[model samples]
Target: MTTNLPLPQFYSQILSTLQPIFDDTLPLSDPSTQSTLTSALDNLYLIQRMINSLGVFSENESIDEVGEKEIVFMSLNWVIGAAEEKGGLGGRDDRLSALQRAETAYTSYLEILNSYGVLSPEEQAESSAAASGQSSTPKDPAKKREAKIRQYKREKELRENIANSLPNQPESSSSPITFLLCLLPSTSNRPSVISASTGSTSVNQEDPDEVSKSTAILILRLLHTITIASLSSISMEMELLSNAPASIVPLSDRDPREVRREEEDNTWKLDRQPSKYKPRELISGNGRVLRPFTILPSTSDMSDRERLKSGVFKQSWRLPTMTIDEYLEEEQRRGNIITGGGQASYDAPTESELLELAAENDGSALAEEKAEQKRLKDENWARFADENKKGAGNTMNKG
Candidate 1:
């Protein structure tokens, strides 16, 4: 015959009782308080019997029941001990204080039950043997020491392996200037004063686009300065070393510009310009020194009427004019060119060449004549078609 168990109901009662004790707003005068307190006391008694049923201590209680009881007992004891040690359950008039005290006493009882339940049959035998003055051989001390050493070595090896598995990080280049540059405003208000001493009229007033461009230029300059400073420091360090490689010592000690050029040459291979146009040497007024041509705007003093009549304002195009040497220098600085090639082949088209090209394409009067002939032909065709349609309709009506 099978016997029904009351374990589920018992566990449910314990949970239901403990739930109200954890609720802060529940009043002492409330009817549920009496029920809650009664349930709590009853659950504590049931828990002790449950431990006895578990054969955790020499068949006195089953293993499962004993384990569950021991866990709950230890947890409750810890909470109650903490609360009492903190002096959090001393007041008499406070309902929570009284509940806490009750719970503490229950916890202490549960701890005693747990301690009794944890004493295994072998341990009890050992204790009895000790009380009777029967000497039992102790465990080997050397083996225990060896085991501890092996455990420590295993843990150390595991930690080292973990550290080695992590990726190596590059050295940080953070500095005060880097931090300031990062925090600098990307764009500033227009008409910013250059200095306190400068008048308002002397200030550089920039729109949003100009402000952004200027800020970007400033950041690039700062980065360039930091790179150069770092390179110089490395050079100084190399100079102090006695056994440095010859290449390292000489290259490191070179000027920042030369170092930059070497670095660029290693990274970029220059491509030759396309060869469609013939290159020309620009001559200066002295006739000996080659000079670049400069394109200037027509004198700006002309009236609006005069500018319109001359068609100068309507047909004008603006081209950037800079010396060939200056252009070559800029290209070299940008790593766009390596060789100091003499000059650019491309030049601005002259005024006479432009006028000749326009004259070659001119067909204004001939186009007008063709359009007039087409219009007359279309008008005559329309009138003849209308007359033919009227004659056909009259003939059909007469028949």
Candidate 2:
């Protein structure tokens, strides 16, 4: 019962421009309205065709995977916006129940997006760390709140500054999209992603990449949902078959005991189960529960010696199977070699040893050395005296 899905061709940009007009003129079915509806449908079909070109199987995709695609989101947005048009799929006034059902389905889909948490601690810290070139893990509740506050303040200040710097002209508010763009956070680095901005909203595009990524993701998620809804019947049939027993296996042949055992095994246990031993609690001297001591790492701890000293570091790989005696023996051998097998003493040198060293120093043929020096000094003095006397005699002769 599978029909070949039609591939429509039209530019996304062109189709996007007509959305407002369609919304305004809906509930009417004149020639112009019909033509407009036809054109819009054509545009939607074209976009779907382009998306179908990717050959994605909705059944095989996880929600996250589908969410990451742009076209799926676009398709979903289109479905939500145009599904209730006068002559569209859920258009009949008499089929109000069907429209309500569709709305419920779409709302459920949106809940998935809405239920997403704000930037998680890890994500926020990672983004901050990437920007600041530091690892910032906030362990304390107060610090975590402070980090979030700081992030919000920083982003707000950045946006305000950018807004203030823009030319103060009437064109500043001319486009809702541009206004929204001006409202985007300054931390965003992608300004080119504004190409996907829909429904006459010209984004200020401070960060095109961020806008584009966000828009693309939104569109992809929508498309994924639309695709899923379209194929839900098929999916249900498959699911039923999977859960059904094979035609070859009759229900009567199954063992009742085995079925009962499986049922018992699959049953959930009670929350307060009986334990083999009573629970033990440590109490403080004052009678309160004794909580174990905990260390909360500070910024200084991350940047300083504490970080280096905190963790246990292994210098070598250890074989877990090695015996403690073997390790101790190896250590003893190394220790003996290093310390000279108890030959080295911690005691200081005695007076006797000091005196012995001094005596050895002077006793080493020292008398001969001193005598030689004295002899050299006397010979030099006698030579000088003889030269002086000769000089005196010469002077007397000259006179």
Candidate 3:
């Protein structure tokens, strides 16, 4: 069933309902929340359809030229909602479907932004590369950082400008619905997505567009990871099952590490076994032995009455090869500590930073001294340069 209300009224009613839900005064798990949210989503979709049908925006028309940012803003919000909905869908089929939907929705959103001059040049290039399945070349870190900061400020302004322009019901007209002009959620209210690579939230966006785009990318990435993990688990289970019918198929040779881990896990199920090797027999008295006898040969002949006795004390430890000082001396000879790194080279002044700094601090004596030194250096270089022209060093040809 359609809302059947006028565009502004319908838009206002939906956003008004969404504000509390997004702000979290209304619990997501509450029975009423689902219907309300679903209705809002459906209406937002319908709003886009109606707006498209109105022909305010035409194919190949720039958003800037036509002043259709208000319509476009509503469209962006709808795209965000749609991507979020698909991303939140649970299970294998849902997860698989979500990525395609997210890609389509987000790609169109970015294309619109690119056309409107909202996206930076780098972002536009990246979007094009992504669409074409080509890799973008690496850019200077500083330039990329500067571009991101500019884009951040610009996007924020664009969002605010469009949001504030949302039409309100006229003062004369006593309509029940009023355009709530729902701004993007505060930073604290936005969900934090832990990055797979960095293990932190990559984009902490107050703007729903940024959040939705990041969330969609995350959803696709997570789907890939989940599929890989599930396949690995299934493979392991298959391997275990294959081993059960070993008579038909011999067990495959597994990695020693795998076998060791498996044995470790099943150690409790193993029976105790006797050691194959044992310590040598002590000289305990045995059957048929009249008296204790030494295993070593005697140095001198002795009478039968006399018996050899073993010494109680013998050194078991090895003698030291060298003293601590001798060891230290050897190590020093071998160069124990690394040395001689920064002593040979320093950060030489090859730029105009020194001149700029001296100009900035003209009142200081140090600055005056630096300025004098720089002047002398430049004067000497000038004299040398003027005396020896380019190619003057090629004396072999000259002579």
Candidate 4:
């Protein structure tokens, strides 16, 4: 006695719940955003379970032959999108885990597409070339480094993979509700259904074609973008963990035994008992030593108490090596300055002076009249000077 899956109802709920993601006006900070998204994820997870319960998917099953191919493809897309928004959904424990789940789901979908022979000849050849390192990426060192990093992330995700975790075949005796609860791993612990109503979404049943294959490639690229950033973050976190001291909890909260062990760890111990003590430069400021010691400041650092920061640049005036005159002299030597007369100091007469001398020598009526006026002027000057003698006027400073 088999129980039918209530996919129609779940589909309706999934469509209504997912409407928020497509809404442009919806604010992420809205109180209902997370609640609505959580509900949507639950319905989407239920859909996955429903599809899995039909036993229609397998390593040998081609996407063209599958009835729920479109639904599965879109579901993978939506799941990945949700993972980007909330970090994880339903049974997923964290953001990274959620991304891994999405990656796994998309990869499985791609496998089915490949089996269906949906890729074009050119695309297939390009993919093959990339696999063989012919030219999927550029020859630039930066691009190569990026490719290596992504490859590392991809390989790591694959190695520590967690698949969709579905049943291999359909169970006739099991009800889908029970199968759902069983398959979900933690349905009770996951988000509860907020609301469900009558809704509809168009389901495509077209055979795999070039357009569909192009869409698959797009989805792959989307997954790549979302996963790389998250994987890089995860890698950084792991690096931090490796570098961090071995204590996650506060000293007070740590176990006495652990604290004792940590305290003991600080004490030095030799792997081999040395027969004699040898003087060695174990620590130095120079690069010769692997472990360098901090050079303590003299008494002045404590006296000043500036608490000066390292690595921060502060502009300052350096002590003058020479006076302003010296600097100006150097600049003058470099042809940056000029003094005295640049050209007026020459002994040669200028053209304007020569023209003035010629005008004085030229005998014209104007010159004769100017000479008579000059003689009158000289006589008038002599008479005025004789009249106004040095002590004649009652000046304040008279002798």
Candidate 5:
């Protein structure tokens, strides 16, 4: 008999409970917020169980990345909503405290994944054979050297494999919960400043579009920074693991029986020496080895939905909020700075200077008009002279 999966229902319930809370503004003290949070948390528990159970049927499946993403999204609502005084869990200080705990848990989970090592099937088989003592035992110095070299090669390969398996940004097949998580920060506190401006003290309180636009941009930036930091951290951890000493066996506790034998009858022996194997450079999937704390290129792209709304919100994204009179005064000041003299070296025009400038302009206009009239007079005189010359030529022909 085919068994039904509970994940779909779990997701549905989470959506149902969280959707209402997300859609409306309710007070933190309201009973509905608590009830909704409880429901969402319960559904999240189910989702976690389902994620854990993924490995049961698919041996090769690694749901670690997906599980981390799932839980992060599940926790974001609480993290964001719990701190809001209105329509949030803010009234209770304990819930706000819980947000910090949730953040710590998220960080710890990512760290665990970074540190965990998984051996491949081939490596596992080799290790099993060596542990069982079924492989050829080193009977000479050359054989011992060969064994050490082989082990080193295997370890290098393993490190390369692990490094290649870095986590990626969310894909299209990712749950809608990811987008919802992205929108969570809209409910969080607005920054004192959004776009940088020298004179602007705060964001425009009048424009809701501007507020939403700034909030969205902030969320995208936060996501980008977080993801880059996480990847860089994981890369550093891998590098450290690769460079760390393989073991710490003391010289006094040396086991003679386990040492390489040069002869079957123990007539000859070789000194035990460490392998001198140098590892190759570790590169990521993109062929770049990231240094510790190196900022990766931003993977977060604002969605199409955000782009559509940008026209409305970002219309004045950089513009400062001020009264009409203040705006006019600022503009006039800027004009004076630019036109009065370079770098505001000249003071504002006095009444006499303004009159002089007006007179100069009037005189220039009059001079141009007179020049045009003179040109027309010259043309008329020339036409009259030509007419007279033609009359004189006609009279001469008659004579």
Candidate 6:
């Protein structure tokens, strides 16, 4: 018959064997060392069993304890063997397997301890009393069942309350890259914004650093929109360029002519002025005048160079022809007036010629008048000739 050792002594022996094995410096890779460790753990389990059989160990000792111990030790042995096969402890695969096995063993042991009656002295007394008929008291069976139901309901409520207490989280703020795209100038000509590398249509891939810098500049423009401290923070983070010194006049402050002159400094350029040909003004019968018109530039003084460089001259001014009424207004402003000679011509006919012409008038009126005059002249000549002819015939008979 084996003499059983105290629980503390057995626990200490197990720890002593495990401590050296667990040490970082220990050569756990060596099969001999691993074998020794395994044997020690086996002896410890045997001692535990002996203590349990003698009733010196806690009654709470789990029935599966020996099997669990063997499984853990064998798992570790396999892990060590695998590590050696795979070129030693440096191989992550072997070490990972070992750690997994150790975690499983520890978890199993903790579960066993939790499930078993690992009670304090007071708890042990209460449990013993409950088991004995001396402390057993009868309660209403219906009341006991009601209490159990209440407890179940309370547990369910508690679980639901815990779930309800959790918050609904919101999506994160839009990226600075996305915000910057909204600030870009609107143009019909720009292609659909996309990143070539990602093949994504999202414009957010525009350089975040650049976006941040631009946003800082834009915010600075709207001084009233943000506090000075906020602006300072943005400036520090983005490293924005300082406002240009007061010595430089902003383009807005410059004269239109100066603006144009600066814009067209480049070599390739065109003339900035309208053509020399002016449209003629015509006066109508209704005292209205129509004039050919042209639109003058907003700043006629701006030179060709400034207009070109600034792209201010890219769009030509449109000229609309002035209506007769508008043209007259301009003429009136210049103090011009209509003369009597401006009226169109009309003439009258003599009375005698009018009467004869009317009498001879036919559907072909002019031709009928000429034909009547010719017929009258022929009648007069024929009568004169007949008188002459009678006298001449008498003279010839006397001869």
- Please count the clashing residue pairs in each candidate, in the order shown: 6, 26, 0, 0, 1, 7
Winner on TM-score (1 vs 5): 5
The TM-score, computed over Cα atoms with residue i paired to residue i, of candidate 4 is 0.34
Give candidate 6 misplaced runs (Cα > 4 Å).
Answer: 1-7, 55-108, 116-399
Candidate scoring better on TM-score of 2 and 4: 4
Worst 10 residues of 1 by lDDT: 169-178
What lDDT tens digits, residue by residue, belong to model 3 across residues 306-391?
Answer: 42232223224322223345444445565664655573635644445667577568689888877877788889999999999988
Better of 1 and 3 by lDDT: 3
Question: Would you list the C-alpha lDDT of every candidate in the order shown?
Answer: 0.38, 0.40, 0.45, 0.43, 0.39, 0.38
Ranked by lDDT, top first: 3, 4, 2, 5, 6, 1
* Candidate with the greatest lDDT versus the true structure: 3
> Which stretches of model 3 miss by more than 4 angstroms?
24-32, 67-87, 115-123, 130-399
Sequence-dependent TM-score of model 6: 0.19
Task: Compute the lDDT of residue 291 as modeled in candidate 6.
Answer: 38
Query: On residues 84-119, what C-alpha lDDT tens digit does candidate 2 reach at each position?
Result: 333332232323433444444334333334334223
Q: 330-354, model 6: which lDDT tens digit per residue?
A: 6776567563442342244444455
| Residue-wise C-alpha lDDT for candidate 1, range 165-284, written one tens digit per residue | 212210122221211122222222211222222223332222222223223222222322222223233334334432432324356567989888777753422223343322233333
Candidate 1 residue spans exceeding 4 A from truth: 1-9, 53-70, 76-399
Name the lDDT of candidate 6: 0.38
lDDT of 2 at 293: 21
Best by TM-score: 3
Put down candidate 5 lDDT per residue, 121-189, tens digits, no spaces. Answer: 443343333323234335598987886577556444433332222121222222223333333222222
Model 2 residue 160 lDDT score: 44
